[model samples]
Target: MNYSVKNILLATSFQHKISVSIFYPENSSNKSIIISSATGVLQKYYSRFASHFSSLGFTVYTFDYYGIGASNSKSIKHITANLNAWAFDQAAVIKYAKETNPEHKIILITHSIGGQLMGLNAEIKLVDSIITIASQTGYWKYFKGFSRFRMFMFWYVLIPFTTPIFGYFPAKKLGLFENIPKQVAYQWRQWGIHPNYMFGHFKNTELYFSTVSCPVLILSFPRDLFASKASVDWLASKLTHAKVDRRHLIPADLNIKDVQHFGYFKKEYQDSLWKLTETWINENS
Candidate 1:
């Protein structure tokens, strides 16, 4: 229940400002980590989740993606938005964590698309471990006819046309696009697809899954609209290491109707994740 808040910036050069925010644990014994958010909301929205790790003594941190949060969404205008660039941002945050908290253990808690992206460029190596929650693994409805076509449109047309206009549509009209960058929006559409959309990033995400060496924990929900148990298991199978753990299929007991993807951040399951993280960190680290 106790924490500290600090504004952060990690830059390659004095001119490039990388914005981030941190929540440090009370009576801490652990070091630090980077928590990647899903499509909507700011770094602060994950505060309760971060509090779990921080409260257990680990410093928890998060940042806005180039066109997402508090960071330079403007880069969206010029750079070609792709999966790799986001990994670079994550790597930068890892670097900053190492420099800022020299000796604390480091971990990567990547959610959704962030979890699927580590293998794009091949340079990620600082985190001690990784935890991917409700992340996309693969989506080849066995490469059926309809699936392949959806992939074509998201990658070739619709995303290319629409992302430049909407980077991440907010749940409650979050004003997430006031400073929308054309290029970033374009890239997001290419990467971001409705779960049931034609064909999702099955091959690419699996490729990245194979390359990550750190201990990994893959949490998947059975009722998730975005990711399924089969997808998480596919990712786990690809990891060369045996350290991959599974938090299998958390079901939402919600009165509403769905236990769908990204619900780990919702009111129903956030605390469950907190407990899982706390217990996992305690047992493992």
Candidate 2:
């Protein structure tokens, strides 16, 4: 295994310097993999998981979102949390990965929101296979009525009226709005009006899954807020691919605890996740 860390500039004016690690299995074929993080999480979060894939003989490229991880970017505003920005981040990282490893087939493995953005673009042939864990589908629209009133106060009134005079306003404990430019927060609030975190205006998570034509493996937990059992089944039905596999992991049969959202990537429980992931990759590729 050979490892190197470097920053790659993205066309979206985002800094996404990721740790590009390469591995060569004595008898393995050449393969390239890119792992993008969920929103606000850095690329390093997948260090262990990247190591797992690499051990299985993959040259892995993992990077953070615009505002998160090693890349430098304008301060993360509320708007950056939206799906559009996330999709941009994904496109940039994909381009970077292709440039770095032109000879290999590129596959994507992501967690949560990373899966959502993959759905938005409708560009599949570029990728060989995709694996998503605890990824969600559909709207958070349950908040629509309560959200409209808040948006009026924040964007139409607060940001427009207060920003120039106050220079900034407080956003949580992080001073996000005040410390960051008001424009960023304003955009964020505009998008936040929807319940869904990313791609709020889209039809549903299942609809997004339907648009995907490549081999996709979805792992979701019932305890997870987004990927309910029905949602997983809905996605499976829409996949259209006879080979796409969907699995739901619940907690111990003792019923003491439920499977966690992100913990599936951890070593303790990831044994099964890895086995299934590698099998899918090898079989499909």
Specify the highest-lDDT model's number: 1
lDDT of 1 by residue, 1-285 (tens): 577878876663223455788887777676686887665446767776776667667888988766555776454445344444566676678777877787777778878767755655243566678888877643533133554565455456654555545543222343322333454444455444435321254454534555566678888766554466666665566567548887775354433334556567655554565566666765665
The C-alpha RMSD of each candidate to the native structure, in angstroms, is 5.3, 6.3
For residue 233, give model 1's deviation from the true position in Å: 3.1
Clashing pairs in 2: 7-17, 79-188, 138-205, 140-196
Residue range 1-285, candidate 2, lDDT tens digits: 444344444455233332333433343356777786664555666777777777676777776554453443444443234345556667666665667667767788877667766765434446777777766543333213434344345555665666566443344333222133344445544544544433344566523555566777777775554445554454456557535777776656424346555666677546666676788888876
| Best candidate according to TM-score | 1
Steric collisions counted per model: 3, 4
Model 2 alpha-carbon drift over 4 Å, by segment: 1-7, 10-28, 77-82, 141-211, 232-243, 251-258
| Candidate 1 wrong stretches, greater than 4 Å | 12-15, 73-81, 121-123, 138-157, 163-211, 252-258, 267-271
**TM-score of decoy 2:** 0.67
Compared with the true structure, the alpha-carbon lDDT of candidate 2 equals: 0.57
Error of 2 at 123 (Å): 4.8
TM-score of each: 0.74, 0.67
